[model samples]
Target: MAVTLRTAILDDIAPVGHLHHRSRRSAYQGMVPDAALDTYGADAAARWWVERWSHERDTHRLTVAEHQGRLIGFTYVGPHEDGEPATGELYAIHVDPGHQGRGVGRALIRDALDTMRERRCRRAVLWVYAANHRARDFYEAGGWRPDGVGRDGWLGPVPTPQLRYALDLTVAAAEPATPAAAQG
Candidate 1:
């Protein structure tokens, strides 16, 4: 299936919310607290997305992937909240469980990185659950590296271990092709 990426709008809240909630539940099933996942549903996620868009729209960017007119994946990127001024961050990226391995995620990441580069960001960073090997592998295959930094974060009421991943966007631009864009 051919996937297209575009900026997300307010009208996309419902579908995006459903996908986000579903993706989180599937991706973090064994890594996050069951209780936290239980309370996270489509409605709650929709509200959360709306709130984030309302408050951070100016500082952040949201991109969605669509296949045959259906929203299947999304990515959020922006200036790094805890890093240097030239550093960008990939705050979140999710592809519906039903749509995994179909290039939706690969497209989203490529689009996110492109946006970061357009914004003149020199580097990028993101955090992932330490136990999420699948996601870690995906990012690593996309040329992201673990920065040897770890932190404690709450997945609902459960404390979880997270690791930081970084990419030098300047170096990426100097290369002929980005791993994400080169993904088959």
Candidate 2:
């Protein structure tokens, strides 16, 4: 089974929201209170995505990954949070729990980096829950490293700490040693 990656369209926003809800619940279990996960249901997620995408479509990129006829994952990329020129930020990448560990995430990140590169970005950065060892390991394995920056962020009503991880897009895209380039 192959996962297909494509630029997300209006029709995909709803599904992206639904998948995001599930992926968040699964990935953030125990990290955040259950109430935090339950605060926003799938419908809310869909609406939120629709609203956000409507405003950001021009400056941001949203991509969906499909397995067969179903959307299994998505990735969102845009300018850096602080508006750093030439720096792109991967705001989110979520894979359905059932579909994870099957290359969906790897594909999404690669596509995200490609999108950033197309945006003329030389650097890529993302924030991850500091306690999420699995996600941290996954990104580290892909050549992303913590840049020693941490921030307190909120998930629903819960406050959490996150670490900023960065990757030199030019190096990863051009270096054969990078996992992303190896896939190419």
Candidate 3:
């Protein structure tokens, strides 16, 4: 089935939440304690997404990837978390584990980069849990490099070490056909 990427609407909150929970658990299985993973459930994820989107929609972009009409992945991007006007932050990217390694994540990432480029940001940054080797590898493969900064982060009330990664967005490149322009 062809995977389609598009901006998420209010209607997608619930399913995105569900998929997020599944994705997180699958991705963090051995990296995080089962108890910590359970601290935030699907319903809570749904509500969090709802509240977040409601407040940040104006400044952030939430793009979702769907396969056969089912939500399969999502990426969230916004202005740099610490108010850096020329930088953007990739807040989250969650892919349905079953649908991973099939280019959905790459597509979403391309879309996010395009969006940040459109927003006139010259740099982009993200934080990843230090123990998430899979995620770290993925981001590194995507041209992100750690800035040698570590910070105290949280995952459902569990304190976790995180590293900040950055990408220079100022290099001009052909705009790839992304979700916003190609599909939605």
Candidate 3 global lDDT: 0.81
Better of 1 and 3 by lDDT: 3
TM-score of 1: 0.91
**lDDT tens digits by residue: candidate 1, 1-184:** 8988889998986677788888888888877668888876889898899988888888999998888998988988888988588889999888888888766677788788899999999898899888887887778777788999889977677887889889998876322222222111
lDDT by residue (tens digit), candidate 3, 23-102: 88888788778999899999998888899899999999999999988898998999998998799999988888887777
Error of 1 at 164 (Å): 0.8
Q: Which stretches of candidate 2 lie over 4 Å from their true place?
A: 173-184
**Could you tell me which 10 consecutive residues in candidate 2 have the lowest summed lDDT?**
175-184
Worst 10 residues of 3 by lDDT: 175-184
Ten consecutive residues with minimal summed lDDT in candidate 1?
A: 175-184
Q: Please give the clash total of every predicted structure, in order.
A: 0, 0, 0
Candidate 3's C-alpha runs over 4 A off are 172-184
lDDT values of the candidates?
A: 0.80, 0.85, 0.81
